[model samples]
Target: MVVLPMKEGDFIKIEYDAFVKETDQLMDTTHEEVAKEHDLYNERATYGPMSVVVGSGTLIKGLEEALKDAEVGKEIEVEIPPKDAFGDRDPKLIEVFPMNRILSLPEFRKGDQYPAEGMEIRINNRTGVISRIFAGRVRVDFNNRWAGRTLVYKFKVTELIEDRDDRMRALISSVYPHSEEFSFEFGDEDAVDIILPDIVKLDTNWAMAKFKLISDLRKYMDLRTIRLIEVYMKREEEEEHDHGSEHSHEHDDKAPAEKGSEGEKKGEEPSENKEASTDGEEKADEKKE
Candidate 1:
């Protein structure tokens, strides 16, 4: 299939699987129902590029580095060496802490984990926290659980689609499925009743995700079918969860990433905000009949 450059906002479609080096058996994957106990679950691992922000820390370091050179919709095979993928068993990473530290915390279960503070945690899997007490010291290995394994990844990119407005609507729906947040506005000063919730602040990245979705929706004329919707920004809660936290915490289920929420990035400078916002308004106006 034809491959395109993976733009910053391009929606990536791809599949990945990890194979055992010795047996070539498909040990684990991201596709099927992952047991509460394994690395990858399905024989074939697959996930959307939505879960990954390119050049970011979503995938393995080697994979990330490899994909940087990868174009969107381009299928490529990359072999990540153990050292590049996870790294040789870092002798320094393994540690023996005072057993009291492990036994003291009520939340310190064998498999439970928290930030090592500046330490990174791999997404989609439980942190490996095997706490064994020996000679008054608790052995804790901070190295990646699959540190010594070689991985062969085949990325068959389906397509590189732009993030558009439908994607934005979908994103809003994803975040606030229970609440209704859509309305139509007739051009030339018509106000429609909008039940915008107590606002939730958005970080720059999330805002961009929403912006791109809007753009894509416009491209498809999906928004044209409706009158108009003026999306206003508000900060509903003073408290905001770190977007990164969304990945680390185990939600009841993995909320499927929908294709929506496209527009622009949030940034500093109020004067520019007025200009960029007008651009968004113009976008809405462009859809007006």
Candidate 2:
């Protein structure tokens, strides 16, 4: 069995732990047990091997480059400088504002106390953490929390996803983890159809996920068309009622009119055929590229 090295556009599952080189502080990991051991576990996060397309620009520069030519099931450790990880911190990113200005914000105006040091805040579309609170002044640092720190990563490519359907499923599950039961089918003329689960329709993140899924499909797959099918079937009771009505209407003179109306009703099928090509996502693809 020959294990080929990963290359651009390869879909693979990876597990990694990232740490700050200076303090050896664990910044992130794919393993749940490691996160628990470090007391960095998040109740909302799903921890496990993550799916990624190599050279898709989803990973930090150093990490993505390291995975390129790496074989599956081989653990590799690499040290990444600030330049390739998060970039060096810039002093210009630190700004000091009048303490009164911070206190006057809408959040604090409602009786909230002065923000304590290390508290993160978002203002004017920029997010920063409170670094200092001096006499009548508040200093905020907008640089990334890990800026200027060299990072160390221990990672391994666990599995290579080769099947087209499995690759699509993996990509979808990576973005929307709850979509394990979703169905994918190849259609005529280089098109793929994805039948979304009913639960996804109720998700508030569905809109964003739909667009992201479309973008990723276009980027990674060679499909000319991507369709998201949302099926809203009639309830069993409703179907039974309609069936009874149709049976009675068959014996009536108005049956022809009723059948015509039913034909019109069934025309709603077009509404369920949501094609990515028709949506404005092609423009988004251009912008993303």
Measured by TM-score, how close is model 2 to the native structure? 0.72
| Model 2 lDDT per residue over 1-289, tens place | 3275667888988899999999999999999999999999998888888888887766899999898657788889999999999999999999999988888877788885658899888777799999999998999999999999999999988988888877887788757877577998898747998888988878888889788888888888877898888999989999999999888877686778889899878866755554644576778888899
RMSD (Å) per prediction: 28.1, 23.8
lDDT of 1 by residue, 135-235 (tens): 77656667776677787776655545455433343334433322244533333332223233333244444455445534443443235432223355544
Please give the CA lDDT of all the candidate structures.
0.50, 0.86
**Best model number under TM-score:** 2
Q: Which stretches of candidate 2 lie over 4 Å from their true place?
A: 100-114, 174-177, 197-209, 231-289
Number of backbone-clashing residue pairs for each candidate, in the order shown:
29, 0
Give candidate 2's root-mean-square deviation (CA, Å).
Answer: 23.8
State model 1's lDDT.
0.50
Winning model by lDDT:
2
* lDDT of prediction 2: 0.86
lDDT of 2 at 257: 84
